[model samples]
Target: MKLSKRLQQVAELVPEGAVLADIGSDHAYLPVYLVEQGRIRQAVAGELNQGPYESAQRTVREAGLSHLIEVRKGDGLAVLGAGEASAVAICGMGGGTIVDILSAGRDKLAGVQCLILQPMTDSDRLRKWLHDNGWRIAAEELVVDEGILYEIVQAEPGDERYKDSLWYEIGSVDLLKHHPLFPQKVSAAIKKIGRVLQNLRKSQGGLAAQKREALLQKKKRLEEVLKSCKQR
Candidate 1:
């Protein structure tokens, strides 16, 4: 089955020979594809809603991967049991939602070596949570598909901190790997923060002032990144 560029990037991050659990697995395509390629021996496709749950089941059955992939219906990591998977892939969800899921089902993460996260929004919050909780980012990927940019972060259990605050505020520069869209990503971030600063400037509240200050700092960091990219 064909996967979107975003999902394909997520799939490529999964470690070979590791069992995987694809959370919010819309059609279980990632797990099925991995299994077909012999990248993983087993997988569990978890979906929260019934419609997608049934659809996942159908997909796995149609792919004739019923023995290698199990489609289960439950919210977040609740569908998984301890030691059931070595890696967890939670994609196409908001960063705040992903944080809640990880926090809620943290106990199930025992023995899990890796986490592949693709947050649709507020990824900084998710990264902060991971850093504070001891999940060091092992690798990261950024891909733009159909004019929409997406980030895929692969983290494993460890303790690590960024030398520059921009690593967290913006993202890991080392992980960007000089992607062709690096400039575009930096430009887009600068524009997004510029809009935030504009809106915050019009507001007259203590929180707004603080937010504006933070955004200004972030904007500068992004600009520096953009400049450095141009220099290279």
Candidate 2:
């Protein structure tokens, strides 16, 4: 089973011999591939919707991994139990939704050692939540598939401290340093902040001054990062 570049990167981060759970497993390709490769001892593919859930089951059966991989129809981490999986992979979802799923299933994560996350959007929120909570990002990577750049984060439960400003803006600075797509991502962010600043300046309102100031500050910070990236 061939996985996308993003999914392949996420799978590579999974520790060998792990009991893995793939949350929101759309096609169950990742788990099936992992099991077949002998990377994991057991795997579970969790899906909430009927169409995807049935598809995942079919894929697992077709791959002849039904015994090693269990397809469970459920939402988020609700299908998992403590110690059932040592590592969890939640991918191809919005960061806020991923954070909500992890936040809601904190108990199930007690015995888990690693969380491999790939957020589609709002990655800053997910990073903030991880930092505020106990999870600390151990590694991060960037993968470009079909002209889209995806960020993959590997975190473990602990007091992992991150610089607040960098964490809020770029998800993880350590990851950003080695990011394959950092130039593109940071350039896009700089353009976005510039656009927001322009709009704030053009608008005339009672709070325009304050809003403009905030936007300017954000723009400056982004500019600094952009400049640093260029320097390197």
lDDT of 1 by residue, 75-140 (tens): 999999998999999999999999999999999999999999999998889989999998999988
Candidate 2, residue 2: the lDDT equals 88
TM-score of each: 0.93, 0.94
Prediction 2 TM-score vs. true? 0.94
Error of 2 at 51 (Å): 0.8
Residue 15 C-alpha lDDT in model 1: 96
Per-residue alpha-carbon lDDT of candidate 2 for residues 59-136, written as tens digits (9 for 90 to 100): 999998898999999989999988799999999999999999999988888779999999999988888888888888
* Residue 129 miss distance in model 2 (angstroms): 1.3
The backbone clash count of each candidate, in order, is: 0, 0
The root-mean-square deviation over C-alpha atoms between each candidate and the true structure, in angstroms, is 1.9, 1.5
For model 1, the stretches where C-alpha displacement exceeds 4 angstroms are 200-214
Which candidate number maximizes lDDT?
Answer: 1
